[model samples]
Target: MLLAIILVTLIVLIMLRVPVAFSILGTGFLGLVLLGGLGHALPILETAPATAVRNSSLSAISLFMLMAQFMLMSGLLDSLFDAARSLVGRIPGGTGVASVGAGTAFAAVSGSSTAAAATLAQTSTKRMLSEGYQQTVASGLVASVGTLAAMIPPSIILVFYAITAEASVGDVLVAGFFPGLLIAIAMVATMYVGMAFQKGAVPAGQRSTWAEKWKSLWHASPLLFIFVAVVGSIFLGIATPTEAAALGALVALILVVARGRFTTQKFLVAVAETVKSTAMILAIVMAAHVLGHFLTETRTAPKLVQAIEDSAMPALLVMVLIAAFYVLLGFFMDQVAIIALTVPIVLPVVEELGYDAVWFGIFMILLAEVGMITPPMGLNVFVVSKSSGIPAVVVFRGAFPYVVVMLLMAMVFLLWPGLVMWVPNLMG
Candidate 1:
């Protein structure tokens, strides 16, 4: 009955448009007061925020967000996209493919999916459309590639997953590298196939000269260096994730300033944006912590885990169900809010099933990336649509093939866990 109330109330509050963090916190607090007394609930609330913020691992989020902001404001995204265009523009649907490539590269530096979609949309969508690309194709490409922001190293979601799962942030970050790239490649391939079957869908264009390609490549080298320095150090154990983030942010700032892109105005905007985004994420984390405490006190996670364990279905089937749930939830919830609210509940079940937390984290993120492109409520879809003036349905159609690629990728990870485990294993 208590679980029923908690679940129902949370859904009700959410449907009423209450912010997810507040809805979870409010429902949990009310449950605690009713079930365990106000005395118990008050202390938990007071401590939860402090405990959530005290995590040094979480500091990486703000650092990475700031770095992303610097990169976005400083025109690094533009450079990368230009280089990608020069290199791939000759192929069918090449601009769309290049958008995915650029987003993948930007993801290494900018950890936010929405920011990636926005930045890439601002940089490439209009141009792609102007180049005679289909509107749906242009918008869909941005929405799908934007999700790479969450899969790539330095992802804010990965940081939260590390803290919640008590896994290494660096390990989770490193584990993401190959899988992220694989998804990017798959997305590009999907574009190629889509264009191939539907002739004239993506107009072919002239290829750049080798010199022009090299110049484009030269302009993007700063981002390449930052990626190697930051991701490479973490993967090689030369620096902790937090230290790497700080170092990355410094490098990003320098690149922006050296390029004369950073004005006092731009610097202040980046700082302000970072603070606002960080505060929003932190608030959700704190609230989710309070709700997590309540769930733990009630033994909700264990109960669910036991039920799953007793079920007749194979563990793989259960995993698929959970992934599907994330897809549905992703349609309506922000990725961070979903992570904060669901991980505490679902992770125990994942562990009981004998999957590595790091692998599961990667899988979960890949599922969430689908949500970012999936529907009436897929945030990235809306972001790209708004930026590109393309209809949401068109973006949805464009992203449909990529969604299949993601689902297939999820199955691959499930069947061959080595795809995700290989990197972390080697580092060990």
Candidate 2:
């Protein structure tokens, strides 16, 4: 009863618009006091921030954020989008499809879903809307494609999951490759289908001349190089994710300087943004750790796992319930908070039920992606709205089909876990 009350109170606080970090921290502090007295709780509160900050993996968050900020400031994604448009924009729904491609390409170097959505939304929405595409389709494509960052390699969410779950960061990063590709393909397919049935959902784009296409490609090549350098280093076992992030940030800085786009003010802004984002993420990590410690003291995970095992529920059904629970929770919570709060309680049950942690990470990322584009609290949707000057409801409307695609992808993973595990297996 105490545990239930604690969880319900935390949920209520989140719904009441309390800052997530503070809500989690306060709830955890209260739970710890109730369970183990102030003496036990005080030590954990005092120590969690330091311990979490000590994780070297946490530094990658800042480095990757810097890399992404530099890329955005360099205006390189503009050329990348042009190149993708030149290559595909002549087909029906092509601009929308190009947005997906650009998002995928950008996700290789960007560890953030919001950054991907905002950058692409700013670039794609105007072109698509100008070309007669519907507002929802234009903004929604940007929002849905942004979620590609969540499952793509170099994803910050994957890094956080690895550190929290004590799984191999390398394996978890590699595991995302195929499932990410699967989701991207699904997004494109959803666009194509919408174009078919909705007529003007996406209008055909002007074709680029061969000369223009080559020029666009030339301008985009540098950004592509950064992607190859960062992701290739990881895929080829040349560096850890942290090393690759540093290399990518350095390369981005070099590229910006080479292009004469580097400004001290912009660089400082990037660094400041990196610090701000890193602090927010780490604070959540610290709070979640405190809460997790309290939950563990209550043996909640073990008890939950035992209950599932003793209920005669098939492993597949249990997995479905877990996925569904994540999707529902995602409607109300941010992905990082969802992962931090639930993984501690749910992961052991998943492992006991014979699911691989790496595979489950991919599964959870898919749910996260869905959550990012869902109605009401869809962060990416609102980002797209703000970036494109479109209404949030329009973005959400456009995202509905893509949300179905995500749900279908989740089912595909449930049916064949190997799709999520194959690349990671190749990592050995």
TM-scores vs. true structure, each candidate:
0.97, 0.97
> Residue by residue across 352-386, what tens digits does model 1's lDDT show?
89898899999998887788888757788888888
Query: Which residue segments of model 2 deviate by more than 4 Å?
Result: none
CA lDDT, every model vs. true structure = 0.86, 0.86
RMSD of each: 1.4, 1.3
Q: Write the per-residue lDDT of candidate 2 for residues 368-414, one digit (tens) a residue.
A: 67888897689999998998899898889898988998999999998
C-alpha positional error of residue 255 in candidate 1 after TM-score superposition, expressed in Å? 1.0
**Residue 233 in model 2: lDDT:** 86
